[model samples]
Target: MDVDYELIRTREVRSQKKINFPDKVQRNVSFEHRAHGESVEWHYEENEGVAVISNDRLSDERYVHIKRANVMDDGVNIRPPNDLIEDLSRPIYKGMTTVYLAHEDMLEGDIRSVYLLTESQAFTLIGERTDDSKELREVLSNTPRFLPIPE
Candidate 1:
């Protein structure tokens, strides 16, 4: 079956709040949902990237991992640069019963982009660097403004 997935909306994930957590607990980045969709699928292109979506805000230790790729049963995917992918996967902290989306891709891995959907807000992580939180925040704050408010 062929599914024509349309670009319903797109928003640059940015942290609106800060979280204080111990080093052991993996704290993911946070962002607000400027747009909403019931069955929305997120698409991104990177080298064997894995996106982890969690509802930890509602339930502790609950997450869904998605491999961001370009090819799927349904033909829908966007080829984002490695730099961009890494930028999108920064760690954020906030509380809003939101959904979290995180991604990680190795330097020498297969190049596949994929997408996933959720019911609430989510955080994202990419690459394997744990010391780039500051850089990620700067990148998000500067370029690529948020998607315009929908009518």
Candidate 2:
């Protein structure tokens, strides 16, 4: 059986995920993506939370240090950054998947090094693309916990 779904390019993908929290309390969720002698620090802040996610991986000029701010309580909406949509060739990852949440757009790239960040852990969906429909059907049949994103 062939799987039919809407696959949007990374640049055009918009996330339905949102962050809501109290303004007075400082909530910091920090994670490090260190590899190939490059240590990249990622943080989830209040107002800047959405900005960080959309900007970090997609920007041409990487941020050396993302400034953390505490501001009035407001809901932060997440979406793919403008730069990413304009340029589909930006390098977010090479052959391997990073620790960050895998946006659905990653699947549309030439290198389908897609990683899905779940509640408890992360899953890699690399090297799943193939020209042979028979082989592709076999792989998808046995795959676990895979779900299509709703538009």
Candidate 3:
């Protein structure tokens, strides 16, 4: 059976840091996507003072680092950083899925490769230097309810 997914809700959570960076604040924004028989929660944390930006999927406890970049003079060029790829693939095994998350600018014939994430797992590669308008919309629309949300 074909399952249809939809974004159901979004929530923002904020908290004050008590340890090393007492003056800094951390923010977590969550998005919930649901399908006919399943749902997934995805969220990202932002801490500007420490330059920490990451995403996590509440389901499988998988998390990844988001590296942001700005538009260059030439154009909106995007490629997953080698370090991130290495880190994500460190636990490489058979049937592992790699999903390339790119800014909209990088989607127009700029993507070098495409990998499918299984219904049970997935990861995101965010481009910090470019605008994510297209990528954001596409992700919300195409992401399945079973893929792990970035934490």
Say which prediction, candidate 1 or candidate 3, comes out ahead on TM-score: 3
Supply the global lDDT for candidate 3: 0.25
Task: Give the per-residue lDDT of model 1 (tens digit) for 59-124.
Answer: 112222223222211222122234333534432223322222222321112222122212121222
Two-way TM-score contest, 1 vs 2, winner:
2
Where's the lowest-lDDT run of ten residues in candidate 2? Answer: 22-31
Instruction: Say which candidate scores most in lDDT.
Output: 2
What TM-score against the true fold does each predicted structure earn? 0.18, 0.21, 0.23
Clashes of each: 22, 0, 13
Report the candidate with higher lDDT, 1 versus 2. 2
- Which candidate comes out best when scored by TM-score? 3
* Number of the candidate with higher TM-score, 2 or 3: 3
lDDT of 2 at 126: 23
Error of model 3, residue 114, in angstroms: 11
Error of 3 at 16 (Å): 40
The whole-model C-alpha lDDT of candidate 1 against the native structure comes to 0.25
The lDDT of each candidate is 0.25, 0.28, 0.25
